[model samples]
Target: MASERDYFHLSGPLHLTHVKWDNLYHRKSVAASLVQGVYVQEKDRQEQRKGPNALAFPWWAFFHFQLLHTLVDDVDNSIFGAIYEFKPPPSKCNDTLHKTPRYVIAFRGTIKKPDSISRDIELDLQFIRNGLHQTSRSNIAIEAVRNMVASVGGSNLWLAGHSLGSCMTLLAGKDMAKNGILIESFLFNPPYASAPIERIRSKKLKHRLRIASSVVKAGLAIAMKDKKSSSFDSLSAWIPCLFVNPSDYICSEYVGYFEHRRKMEEIGAGSIEKVATQNSVISLMMSAFGKESEPLHLIPSATLAVNFTPSRNFKEAHGIHQWWKPDLCLQSKLYKY
Candidate 1:
């Protein structure tokens, strides 16, 4: 809280600039990757949409499965960036909102290295799927987030993610809230979107874009100067869509829906339900993976629980051309949601 830079999760501990692991699942080889998969993002892009009545309804934008987190003294004239090639649609945002919420996004269903933060794993498919060893993983990601919130001068926060990332995020949100962190969360295309029974994926459908950069100078001219309305006081999320058909989502991919969809719904809706179902096709496969038995009539709720998107429906639509590509260079606006 001393300085903006001081408000980071781990300043010195950023040591894991490169993470090391192994292909233990296959051959006896080792691997190196960025810690926390901070460099890896799902899908998204940036577009210039300067509104006359308004300009920054959706301050930023991203792809379907990419991950992005930002903190700013001025939510106006925002700097938007992604970690990958594809850029997601910016259709999940509100133009003139009642409150400004903390934005969080994660990829769903897609499994990451055991560290959950490592993203550059190029081993065999089965090898990488083993949930390989991940070093320097954070048990409490919200702590890193909490650090961010503190730096932003806010007590309330918004959380969101897709697939596996979404599940993990909700779990962290629960931990943060239980630990007395005033925060709200959103799950975009998360695998699980149920409370009692697991579902295929979120049903919320929609798109969100990033349009803060180009029009920031003229856009936030009015919104930013508003002393009464502030970002810190109104931290909430409006991403994630429910699986119109939860029965199609997979267990591992649908983790967030199970851990936090209900709670997220209590705070946010619309995108929190359907969009996730639309992003990934794996949910449908997972929906068909398990069998219907007696006591455990549903799928296992232990390791990698949560529904997934079906192949026939929500397939891997990641690309600058597709509506779900995650873009970081910030110069793409040709796709539609």
Candidate 2:
């Protein structure tokens, strides 16, 4: 697999110092840059065999942010996430937007390198099984997020992650949101652990399949009604920004997910859709087998941004680099409760 550096060259100096923090594109660029920084830091650890050096820290500086902490997986000693404190220049300090976060926590996705691949893949499997929250690395992340929120408050912090790391941030963000703490979040190419129904070319056939799936899921949800919780409804007020590419099968399901809900509502099946959307087939199956699980992809609300620009391949489609590009063709919509 090609490294992030191979996909997008960052050897040259970055020119984002003057970008406004309140702008949507710039916020995405900054979030993606921070996540990329974690990837570079991991690569540096693997190549240097010593630890991450000064070179691995340049990504944050480009956005006028100082690295505050690195969240490492104890088993692999890989850099999976980092906390950054915004430190604008004296001239730009007063101009910074009030909504700008004082601190941002960003997480990197899977790296296929020998140093981190094993643990990263393990987390991926756990994610698929909806058991990621049971992992030690996840516990570590939750603790870090909890401590940060307690210290700085949720409004002053932001959460950003890509791919598997997006799953991590989603879990953390959901956990915090459940406790009435709403943090700004950016999720890039977050994995949706289900069939790639969005990739089906036949819209009619796809809609039929979705309706069938919804019926089954809704039935299962009703069957387990005694175990149901309205806690997830509380998350309706916390809307995260979800960046997805239609060509990226990993995250493309989100497009269909939101669209399916709208379709169901149009047909007056909104009640069934509500139960179906809250529960997934896999999660219901797990529950039947006496395994408690929460589908990681289920969210109450999001600002879903779909990239319409063509991708050369799956790598390009799913890459974090695309979000920072200036010429992206995107269609964004706010999906609320």
Candidate 3:
């Protein structure tokens, strides 16, 4: 039988052990690895019945972090997220290179397996309906994050997740930001519920459609001024790091989401763009039906990082494994509200 280490493709003797603590790439790699660890933990649980000592920590050794807690889905009893406490070597304890977070809460995305697929897909659908926060899994994750923040404070705590898990992180981070607790967060391939306008082939047609959509959304915002409010404005300063691939339609819209805002500014429609970006059409429709929903994709600020490197397929493009790779062609820009 293959060992758990064989399952981890990125972490081993050849992994990023030499990278300093303050290296941005290293931090990204560590966050991705920790999230992957949650996947391995779940796999261990599934296989534990086969033999003794089946549980494993595949990525822990490479990053010098210990699993402090695992956030399990109450319905399926499967692991979804984990809290890792950094355990640097004694030799490097006094070095200023220890600027990294003392604790990190990383969430894993959907795992397509018989043991966890149902719950994962259910949460994915809830994500589409903007009802993910109402699930018990979300409640558990938010409580875990909140307790961690209260235990150690937010200054040295970090939140990270990929895909559906990224949605959880965004919601949790937003909740914390709303209460004046700003924690560093990294979101990879987070799904945007809006249409995939970025997939359109014609640049001119795409631009025109975006402009029309923005105008309509802006008009609706003005017409519903009394009913709607900019609750996200307070989160303007808490910018999470968003990692996206242009080839991945689930997340690629974010590339245009931020870019379109800039174009709106260039055309002197900054005020319209502000209102339109804060409120999505789905949220407006829900309000019409007397249903309150918060669009999980909308955010006031983010440090958007787009991968320019061409991917082989959607799976390769959307995989969390790519974020930990050292030689990635990426373009990063900070969009501030």
For lDDT, the strongest prediction is 2
Model 2 clash pairs are none
| Candidate 3, residue 304: lDDT | 94
Q: What is the lDDT, from 0 to 100, of the residue 269 in candidate 2?
A: 97
Write the residue-wise lDDT of candidate 1 on 276-304 in tens digits. 21211222223334421111011111222
Query: In candidate 2, how many Å is residue 199 off?
Result: 0.4
lDDT of 2 by residue, 1-337 (tens): 3344632235322556577777898888889988888887788778773333335666787667899999999888999999999987767764646758899999999998999999999999999998898899888889999999999999999999999989989999999999999999999999999999999999999999999999999998898772554777888889999999999999999999999998899999998888888888888989989897889899969999999999999999999888987788999999886
How many residue pairs in model 1 have overlapping backbones? 99
Task: Report every candidate's CA lDDT.
Answer: 0.27, 0.87, 0.84
**Stretches of model 1 off by over 4 angstroms after superposition:** 1-95, 102-135, 153-156, 189-247, 251-337
Per-residue C-alpha lDDT of model 3 across residues 1-337, encoded as one tens digit per residue: 4453436543433467565667667777778878777777787777663344443475765667898989989999999999999887866564545578989999989987789999999999998888898999999999999999999999989999999989999989999998999999999999999899999999898889888888888787677762434467878878999999999999999999999999989989888888888777877777668787888889979999998888999998998878877788988999997
Ten-residue segment with the worst summed lDDT in candidate 1? 25-34
| Root mean square deviation (Cα) for candidate 1 | 21.7
